[model samples]
Target: MRWIAILPVLALAACAAPEAPGSERVPAARAIERPFDVSTNVDFILVDKSDRTLTLFRKGTPVRAYRGVAFGDAPTGHKRFQGDERTPEGRYRIEYGNPQSAFHLSLKISYPNAEDRAYAAKHGLSPGGDIFIHGQPNGSPEGQKIASHWTDGCIALSDAEIEELWQTVPDGTPIEIRP
Candidate 1:
C-alpha cells in the first residue's frame, strides 16, 4: 500500500524523461512558427570561426543567423573520429530532415564527403559522421541554455532553435561549418 503512492511520481518522470535509444521523439504539442523562410539552393554560405554563428543567405546579405554551439574543442577541421567534438569546417549540404529525430528535429548536414572519407582512411581512422544541427537530448530544452560546448559530436541548439530551424530551412540547402 505504501508503494502505491510512488507510482504516480514515477509515471510523471517517465513522461518527462528523454527519449530512449531507438525511440522516436517528436516535437512538442504546441507547434511554433519559423522566424524566416530559407530556400533550398543558396548563393553561398558563410561561417565565422571566431563567433559561434551559422548564417544563411541567398546572395550577399544575411537572411538568417543562428547562434550555435561549435565543436567543443576549437572547430578547426574535419572530425577524424568519434570523441573529437570538432565541427567540420567545410562546405556541405542539408541532405535531409527528420521529424521523428531523437533530438526532436534535425537538419542533416552532409559530413564526411569523399575527400573527408579518403582522408580518414589514409590516416587509418573513421571520419566522424551524423553531425547535425539538432535540438537538445530528451526534453531538456532548458538545459541547453546552460551548455557551453559540444558533447554529441553535432551542433546543438535550444529546443526553440530546433523548431525554428526546422521550419525555415529546406532540404538540399548549402551549409558551411567553420572553425
Candidate 2:
C-alpha cells in the first residue's frame, strides 16, 4: 500500500526531470513584438568590433541596436585561420537559421567569402567557418555575464536578445563587420 501511495509522488517528480541531451535551452521569456509590426524590413546589419555593438538599419536609419554583445575570447585582430578565437571582419550575410543550435538559437554568418578564402590561401591557412550570432550556451551560467568576450569565433548575445534577433532578422541579410 505504501508503494501505491508513492506512485503519485513519483509521477509529479517526473515533471521536473533534468533537461534532455541536446536540448535547446533558452533563457527567460521576454516581451518581443512581431516582425511585421516592428518594421517593414531590415536593410542591413553593422557590427563594430571596437564598440562591440550590433546595429540594425532600415533604409539607412538605425532601427535597433543590441548592446553588450560578447565576442571571441581572443578578439584582437581579424580572424586569419581556424581556431583563431577572433571574429572575422568584412561583409557577410545571414546564411541560415539554426533552430537547434547549441547556443539556444543562432543565425549563421556567411564567413570566409571569396576574399577571406583568398587571403587564407595566400597565408597558407584555413579561414575558419561556422560563425554566427548566437544566444548563450545551454546550461551555462555565463549567459548572465555577457559584458566580457567569451565566444569561440562568433557573436554572443543574451538569450532574450537573440530571440528578438532571430525573429526580426532574415536570411541573406547583409552584415558588415568592422574593426
Candidate 3:
C-alpha cells in the first residue's frame, strides 16, 4: 500500500526533471530516426540568423528544418575582416565537403566570392575564408552541452545533424544566410 502511494510521487518527480538542452522531449518508441528523406530533392538551404533555423528547401518548398543552430561567438553584423568572429550574411554555395575536417563533419561554404573580395579590397581588409557549415567542436563529448552561439565564424549544428546534412546536402547547393 505504501509503495503504491509513493508511485505517484515518483512519477511527478520524473515529470519535473529538466530536459537536456537542445533536446526535444519525445517518446523513444515514436521518435523518427531520419525525419526527412535525405535522397529527396533539396534545392536550396536558408539560414535565418534571427530565428537560428537552417531550413532545406526543394523547389521553393520547405523540406526539413533543423533548429538550435549556433553561430560565431561574436555573432553580430557581417564579417569584414580576418578574425571577425561573425558569420557572414550573404549568398554562398556549398563548394565542397571536408571528410577530414577537424569538426565532426563539415561542408565548406564558398565565401570570398568575387563580390566579397571586391568589398574587402575596397576597404583594405582581408576577407577571411574557410567558412563552413559543420558539426560540433573537435573532441567534444557526444553529450556536450551546446550554447546558442559558440564558433569562430561558422554555422554550427549538432554532430548528428551534420551527419545527416552531409548525406543530404550536395556540393553546389545555394545557401542564403540572412541577418
* lDDT for each residue of candidate 1 in 96-119, tens digit (9 for 90 to 100): 888777876877888879988898
lDDT of 2 by residue, 1-179 (tens): 89999999999999987954323222221212224334355768778787777877676656677767789999878888899999998778999899989987999999989988899999999998999999988876854746789898899988887886787788999988877
RMSD of each: 17.5, 18.1, 11.9
Residue 134, candidate 3: C-alpha displacement in angstroms: 0.3
lDDT of each: 0.65, 0.79, 0.81
Tens digit of per-residue lDDT, candidate 3, span 88-160: 8878899989989999889999987888888889989989999999998789999563867988889999898
In order of lDDT, best first, we have 3, 2, 1
* Model 1 TM-score on a 0 to 1 scale: 0.68
Give candidate 3 regions above 4 Å deviation: 1-34
TM-score of each: 0.68, 0.75, 0.78
TM-score ranking of the models: 3, 2, 1
* lDDT at residue 109 of model 1 (Cα atoms): 82
- Model 3 local distance difference test score: 0.81
